[model samples]
Target: MEHKNTPIYNAHSYHTKVPPQGIAPCILHYTDPGDLILDPFCGSGMTGVAALMCAHPPAEALHLVHDARLGPRYAILNDLSPAATHIT
Candidate 1:
C-alpha cells in the first residue's frame, strides 16, 4: 500500500499529541512488522498511528493484525491522563 504524508488520525482534539507526520519516520526506521510499539506518555496515540502507518499504511484505524511470518503487530497506547487515554 502507498503511504500518505499524513494518515487520517487527527480527527479529534489533543493538546499535545505528536503530529503523525513528525513521528512516522522514527517508527518506520526503528520498528518492524509484528512488533509492539509502546508509548508510556501517549497523549493521544500518535505513536500507535505512526507505527500502524509504518507497518500497514492502508489501515483505517488502530488494531491488531496477524502476519504470516511475524504473528501480530501491536500498538500499546497508554497515558496517565484520563482525557488523553480516552482520546487515544
Candidate 2:
C-alpha cells in the first residue's frame, strides 16, 4: 500500500498525498464504471489517478479488485491550496 517510490507518488511533492495504488483498491470496490468521485482535499490528484487506474488495472492489481467493473470512473478534485490544485 505504500507508494513512496512509485512514479506517480514521486512525480510531485505534496504533504497530503495519498498514493494512487493504495486508493485504487477502495475505488474499485466501492464504485462501478462511469461513477463520479469527488475529492475535496485532493493533493497531487492521487484519487483521480486511482479512479483512472481502475479502468485498466495492472496484472498485479487484478487480484485485489473484487468487482468486475473494469472501466473508467470520472473524478472531480479540489484543494484549498492553489499549488495543490495546479498540481492536480
Candidate 3:
C-alpha cells in the first residue's frame, strides 16, 4: 500500500514508529474479524491502530477482503517502554 502521512501517524514521535496504514493491510490479510493480534514490541501501538482500522475500516479501505468478516478484530499491544504503551 502507498504510504500516506496521516494525522494519527504524525501525532507522536517514536524511534521505531510505523504508520497504521502500512500495518493495516497486513492485519487484514492474515486475520479474520474477531481474531486477536499480539504485538510484543508494539512501538507507538500502530498495530493496535491497524487492528481498529480493520474492524472499522475507512471508506478507502473497504476493498480489503477481510471486511467480509462482519466484525472487529482485537489487538494486544505491549512495549518494553512505558512511554510507548502510553502512546497507544
lDDT of each: 0.61, 0.84, 0.77
Kindly report which residue stretches of model 1 are placed more than 4 angstroms away from their true locations once superposed: 1-9, 56-73
User: 1-88, model 3: which lDDT tens digit per residue?
Assistant: 3544778888888887777767776777778888999999998888888898886666445565544454578999888988888888
> What lDDT tens digits, residue by residue, belong to model 1 across residues 1-88?
2323344544776766556645655555556667888789988787877665665443323223333222234689888989888876
TM-score of each: 0.65, 0.88, 0.79
User: With candidate 2 superimposed using the best TM-score fit, by how many Å does residue 81's alpha carbon deviate from the native?
Assistant: 0.8
- As a TM-score, model 3 comes out at 0.79
| Candidate 1 worst ten-residue window by lDDT | 62-71
Model 1: lDDT to the true structure: 0.61
- Candidate 2 structure quality by residue, lDDT tens digits, 1-88: 4667988889989876788877887888889989999999897899999899988976556778755578899999998989998897
Residue 19 lDDT (model 2)? 80
Highest-TM-score candidate: 2
RMSD of each: 7.1, 1.5, 2.4
Backbone clashes (count) for model 3: 0
